[model samples]
Target: MTIEQRYQLAKAQYESWGIDVDAALAKLKQVPISIHCWQGDDVGGFEVNKQALSGGIDVTGNYPGKATTPEELRQDIEQALKLIPGQHRINLHAIYAETNGEIVERDQLKPHHFQNWIDWAKKHQLGIDFNPTLFSHPKADDGLTLSHPDQSIRDFWIRHCQASRRIAEHIGKELGSPVLTNIWIPDGYKDTPSDRLGPRKRLKESLDTIFSEEIDSTYNLDAVESKLFGIGSEAYVVGSHEFYLGYAVQNNKLCLLDTGHYHPTEMVSNKISALLLFSDKVALHVSRPVRWDSDHVVSFDDELKEIGLEIVRNDALNNVLIGLDFFDASINRVAAWTIGTRNMIKALLYALLMPNDQLKVYQEQGDYTKRLAVLEEFKSYPFGAVWDYYCERMDVPAGLDWLDHVNKYEDDVLVKRANKS
Candidate 1:
């Protein structure tokens, strides 16, 4: 059947349940998903003298045609954006700064170092989000950064974060949108630490120093990300969830929850409602973790839907800054971004088409049976038709058609990079 016919029938099905599918599409279009830039190069940012990735995190598989230059990465992102529906923002790291063949220390980075990015962002009309590269640096070689034993190392990272916020501010001012400058450090111990409080205290002090300068929220918003463990710091992570949650609440900073940062049993989706109650805003790094905090591509799984539902049902679309955080070298990089990001958007669309008000009433009236029944019924509903119509209407490829575009682009663009390199 034609996409329009399918959408009309699906709209009727949802309308029967008192759900407004068109309104849901409107809401989904407004929600911007910050696409991570690192995925284009497998986190290999264009630093003059590059350092090996040192965080507990690692990107496996040696996929050829990885972006090696700033322009190339942007080109790959451009291709992916065409395939994915709706407007979105791009997430960048400190290491992505262009230094013009000169070695620039992280602390010494300035707004000019990223002017190329700012100019490009303006060209595409995409807002840019920023992150301080705490991992894969010399100072962090020992798996210590903000919580390092040495005061100098801690001061260095603090300065870097401070610089990052300024850069974010500049980007926000240029793009005319608020930027989320997130800080994620890999400072933990391989074995059990003798003193956890000491590192956490140091981390707290460093954060305070970094955020000492008052930048207007209009330009930049600061967020601290927490992790349970990593490749090296399996025993303890200094910036634990509890620590960051307390720090964010006390300091009025946003706490970034990476889906892969929690334990297997603990779901980041479950924490969304709790944070919304106290904080005015919360940030997310939507990712899929397998057995470990492995940054796998995000899938349209149950948890992803729950997360989307939490944001939509709670009326927190504006309050929650949704962003993606995953790197899988096993498949096409551009396809990785397209697939993961599409799934994220798809999950939200699914949530938007649900009869959330009815479900809430069922729970409130102690009618669990109806709630469960309605939820299962919608699972088999004509959700795909609505999704396809949204994609086609947005002028992007619907269904598996997007994969063909990525494949063609890979052969036409990405493969040439590998051949030259």
Candidate 2:
């Protein structure tokens, strides 16, 4: 059958179940996923004193053609964004600032340090998100930042986070959108610590200091991320999930949930509703974990679909901020971004096409048998037809046709970098 014929059939099938396929597509188009910039550079940012990645996080493999400069990374991102199906924003780490050959310390950074990025984003008509780089520095070599024992070290990180908030506000004001400033510190111990409370107390105090200056909500929103464990901090993580949940609620901040930052058995989809009940907003770092925090490329797997369903079913699309977070240096960096982002949009489209209201009615009416049967039947729906139609509407190559664009770009752009080096 032709693509239009298949979409017509899918539309009829969905309408029979009281679903508005067009409305779903409209909603999906409005939700913007924030694409992480680290994927293009393998987390190697352009800084005067670029330190090796440390603090319990590291990227594996040595993929050739990894972006080594700000211009190259932006070029790669532009290529990837072309293949993605929906509008999106770019998430930037503080380490990615362009200093123009000047030595700028993290704590002393200002909005001007990232003026080029702001201008580039403006040209592309994209919103910008910000993160404080708390790792991969001399001070954080000991697996701690805001929670460090030394007062001077803790103060330094506090200042860096404060500066990051200011930068985020500046970007938001320039772009006319609220920039999400997420703070994730790698502070913990490899082994059981003698004084657990001390680190957490210090962390809380440091957070208070960083957030003391109130910026307009229209300009910037604050989020605190927590991790269950890391490569080195297996035994203890200072900012546990509980700690950040409480902190977010107490401070009226958004809590960030990184899919790989939780236990192996824990799925972040289950925590969305609970967190949203108390917090006004919840930010997500969508990633795939292979038995551990590996930061694999996101796939359109069961968990991803569930995460999308949770957001759509709860009607929390605006309240839940979705973003991609993964770094796999083994594959083509541009392909990694393209594949992960397309899959993320695919998952959301899948959720949008679901018969959520019917399922909810079944559950509320104590019709478990019907609910199970309807849900099982939904698996066979013509979701691919709808996805293809959406991609076509968005003016992006549908199906695997996008792969040709990535391959062509790799041949013309990425491979040349390797040959030159």
Candidate 3:
């Protein structure tokens, strides 16, 4: 059947439930997923003094066609964005700064180092988000950054983060939008620590110093992310969920939650409503974790659908700043981006098509039986029809059609690059 005919049928089903499918599709289009740039290159940023991936995080897989340069990474993102059905933002790290082969220290990285990026962002009409690369540097080689015991190391990272915020401000101003400059550090011990309080106290002080230089929020927004434990931070992490939640609450910064950073049973979806009560905004790093924080490609699993439902059901669409964080080079890099991003959007669409208002009414009225039954039944609804229609309308491929384009791009572009390196 034609995409339009399938969509019309699906639209009628949703309409019968008093759900406005058209409005949902329209709103979904407006929601921009901040696609991380590191995915294209396996987090190997174009730094002259590049270090091995560290900070309790790692990206495995030796995909042959990893984009080795800034231009290539940007071009790769363009290809992924082509298949995705929405206006999106590009999230970049400080390590991605291009210094023309000059050795620019992290603390000294200026906005000009990213002038090419700014110009490219303008050309594509994409918004830019920023992150201070806290890991893989010599200073962070001991797995301690802002929380480092040494006064000089802490001071250096503090300066770098401060510089990062300023760079984000410049980018935000150039792009005419506020940049979400998120700070995630890998400061913890591989074993149990006797002096846990010391590191956290130092971290708080460093953050205070970094944020001391105030930029207008209209240009840049700051967020802090927490981790359960990482490769080096197995025993304890300085920036635990409690620490950042408390810090962000008191300091008025957005608390950035990564899906894989929490214990398996814990749900970021549950935290959304609670955070919305106190904070004006919340940031997310949507990633899939295998056993630990493995950073696998996101699948359209139950949890993902629940996350979408939470954001949509709470009416916190604008309040939640959504971004993708996983990097899997095991498969085709471009295809990995396409799959993860499309699933994220699909989860939102799934929630949008649900009769959320009625479900809430059922819950409020203590009609749990009917609510459970209806929820299960709606899962079998014609969600794909609406989704396929979205892709077609957005001028991207619908269903498996996008695979052809990715495969062709792999053969035409990626293969040649592989042969070169």
Candidate 4:
């Protein structure tokens, strides 16, 4: 049957269960997922100092055709967006600033450094998010930032984070949308630190200084992300989940949850309800971690589905900002972005298609068996058909057809980069 015919049948089947398929599609269309720019370059930014990635973060594989310049990265993103359905935003790190041969220090950066990006985003009618790159710098060589013992070093990072917030506000004002300014620092000890409280105290002081100047929320929002551990920080991480959660609660700031930033068995989906009750909003860096904090491309897996279900079931779509965060240089970067992003969209779409209200009703009535049965039955539904229809409606290629576009772009664009190098 044709796509529309299949969708009609699906719609009728869903109607019998008191679920509105069209409403779900509409809601999914409006939901904007922020695509991280670092994936295109394997987390390599356009900084003048081409230092090795430090502070617990590292991208594996020496994949060819990585975007080495701002122009190339933007081009790669454009290609990925063409195949991914729905309206989305672009997330940028401070290291991606276009300096045009000038040595702009992180603390000295201004909005002009990102004007090209702002202009590019405007052309595509996309909103932008900002992040402070707190790693790979000389100041961060000791695996400490914002919580460093040295006053000068801590001040430098504080200034840089403050500058990042201003830049986010500038972009938001220009684009007429609030920019989510996220702060994720790689500050921890390789071995157990003698005094954990001291570092956290310093970090808190640094954040206070960074957030001293209040920008209107309509233009800029702030979020703090925590990590379990990093390459060098296996024993202790100062900015633990508990630290940021309390800080966010006390300061009324949004807390960011990176799916791969926790232990293997710990699911971020379980934390959604608890966080939603206190914070006005939450931000997410959705990523896949194989065994540890290895940033792998996201897939349509059970954890991803659960994350989506939590957001949809709790009716927190407006309160949660979804963003992709992973870098896999083993494959075509554009295809990586497309695959990860499409999977994210698929997860959310599946969640939207669920009979959440019905499940809630069953649970409230203490009908545990009915709830379990209904959930299992949903697994066998024709979710793929609905997804294909979504891609068609969004004017993107459906199913495996999108892979053809990625292949064509690889030959015409990425292959040339490899040949030139």
Candidate 5:
């Protein structure tokens, strides 16, 4: 049968499965959103599992050894693009080996290295989502934790902020894309809270220095307003820090709605709404929220089913960049890529199937349960509706099937269990 006819049949089958068939099918047919891949830290270096272990780049350690040369990196990205089409991208780090828990100069940025990487990505036609202002970089030896009382340490962070702006302007122009600098400082209360007001003010002072005076002034400052609020148990990143950094930055700056980077009870929609109010260009980094940690997993779609629909119906989905924040056993890179891609497709499909008018009513009247029902109905839709709709409409990996991948994972888990027994 032709693709259109197949869609009609699938639509019918979806209705029979107790889902809102009309709305679901409508969502399925919409233009698929572009998927951006996060090029995790260099996979070339030594992988330290617990204590110098080389199994893979999993959750525990931050060391991703250098396995791919610049040329190889370009080739792998090219291969991924062919495997999965659409405006594909990967997050690029400006400074190499800058976050390896080592001491180094905080006042300088290597422009030549950044320029070379940008050229490489341009040649490959892949876009970059730059993660600047990261405290994990090597220059943050004294730590970007403003709570550091020492004058010299605070001075280093100030220098680091200046360096960040220069690098951002340099790379943003070369890449020709609005540089999305995700500012997530690992600076938070480890035990009891420190001088919250003083440290944060200093941090903001540092940021203000960059926002007001850093950069080549003329470069397009399409800064992505990003911040992390809390870390682990009881520790907080404080509003003064997140707000000053987010608002103090210039306008036209997009805010990155990272899934796992907020307090557990915080509402995701509220966060999105706040950013939407401030900037026209909003972006997202989608991931599963693990207990006290960012799991970087394919988030269970059920979590945001209703809220996601509301956001879309309100016309909020138009100018958002949805990026996948994922990680797996370094050895299981391909598996992570496959599953992460599927999860993203599912999220997009969920947004599409929602009825704009009905969702608006739910939002207007505060009928959360009604909104939730819409999502649950979609979830109950026929299994193959997503497969048939997305696989037919968009450009996905040729032979990669989600059902088959899950089955294989299950088989592997069972075998491992049996061996243990």
Candidate 6:
């Protein structure tokens, strides 16, 4: 159908469901979207094994370590791409420190290997989602903080960022697809909150400097600003989360939100609102909450599922990157891929349907009766109607795989916790 025709049909459908068709249609028009790799292992870090992912590739690796051979790295990328269909468009660093402390010299790969990789990406119709980060190795000295207090660690990360940017710029200019660059640091509060906040501070400052001076404008449109929160319970640096995001925004960067970084009390929806309000900048690291653990998968029905989906739909953030965020020790690669893709489709539908259009009117008017009316409207939505509508529209694969995964563990633990009297 033509774009205009599609819009009209969408509006008619929305109204049929007792929704503000105009508003819903308008909201739908304003969203753009991308997907990231939060489901697969960090390059070659740890394989996530679970019952759901029974017959898939093991999401495991040791980044630069296993990637000692350039061919090995290329093979890994090829395999990962097959699992996540559209993820080829955007790539996240599954294993930043995958090589452990072992660094691969540029010569290790052929003189033209970098360009070859770019060409391969183009061949596969993929755009690079560069997540240059520090944290895969248990022994990774603080590229963001104290481990590099005196340039003690080689400028390994810095060099990679520069190299990746150059490659992205080359491809974006030549191939017309912007390569995205992101920075997320996991170095924080090792012992007694050291006075060495200067290192991380300098690290970010250096990153900003590199982006400012080196990154080509071709790469600007896809730039992402990411932050890591909390460090082993109660350890944090001076300017980690807010500081980095603020800098990125100042330089026009989209904020990348990780799922498991909250301090237990912070609401994801509220955080999203604040970010959206502050800057038209937001990319998501999608994952289901397992108590405090950030199980990187699409959520199965828990208390927070509906609330979170409501926020996504109400906000109409369709264009942002959706990372699976599935980082369990054992996860079935195929199951993770299938479940993530299916969940995202469902999430998109849920977002399209669940706007609290009248809630805003109620709040503005301060009319309790109007608020009640809107609440009743919300409650009136057809039970599982969104899913049914969704399945009708798209080809849905069989079996409620995520439910099975959740039921095995989510029921006993989650139900008992909710049942505490």
Ranked by lDDT from best down, the candidates are 3, 4, 1, 2, 5, 6
Q: Which ten residues in a row have the lowest lDDT in candidate 1?
A: 53-62
Residue-level lDDT tens digits of model 1 in 1-421: 8999999999999999888889899888888899999998889898988988878878998788999999899999999999999999999999999999999999999999999999998888899999999888888899999999899999999899999999999889988999999999999999998999999999999999999998989999999999999899999999999999999999999999999999999989899999999899999999999989888999999999999999989989999999999999988999999999999999999999999998999999999999999999989999999999999989999999998998898889878889999
The lDDT per prediction is 0.93, 0.92, 0.94, 0.93, 0.51, 0.48
Please give, for residues 1-421, the per-residue lDDT of candidate 4 as tens digits: 9998888888788778888888899999999999999999988899886678888888888777899999999999999999999889999999999898888899999999999999999999899999999998899999999999999999999999999999999999999999999999999999988999999999999999998898889999999999999999999999999999999999989999999999999999999989999887989999999989888999999999999999999999999999999999898889899999999989998999899999999999999999999999999888888999999999999989999998899899898998898
Model 1: residues with Cα > 4 Å off, grouped in runs: none
lDDT (0-100) at residue 31 of candidate 2? Answer: 90
Off by over 4 Å in 3: none
Q: Which stretches of candidate 4 lie over 4 Å from their true place?
A: none
> Which runs of model 2 end up more than 4 angstroms from their true locations?
none
Clashing residue pair totals per candidate (backbone < 3 A): 1, 0, 0, 0, 10, 26
lDDT of 3 by residue, 262-300 (tens): 998899989999999989999999989889998898999
For candidate 6, the TM-score is 0.67
Alpha-carbon lDDT of model 1? 0.93
Please provide TM-scores, in order, for all candidate models, with all chains considered together. 0.99, 0.99, 0.99, 0.99, 0.72, 0.67
Which ten residues in a row are the worst by lDDT in model 6?
Answer: 48-57
Q: Which residue segments of model 5 deviate by more than 4 Å?
A: 1-5, 11-58, 61-68, 97-106, 136-147, 214-234, 238-253, 304-311, 362-375, 382-389, 402-421
Ranked by TM-score, the better of candidates 3 and 6 is 3
| Model 5 TM-score on a 0 to 1 scale | 0.72
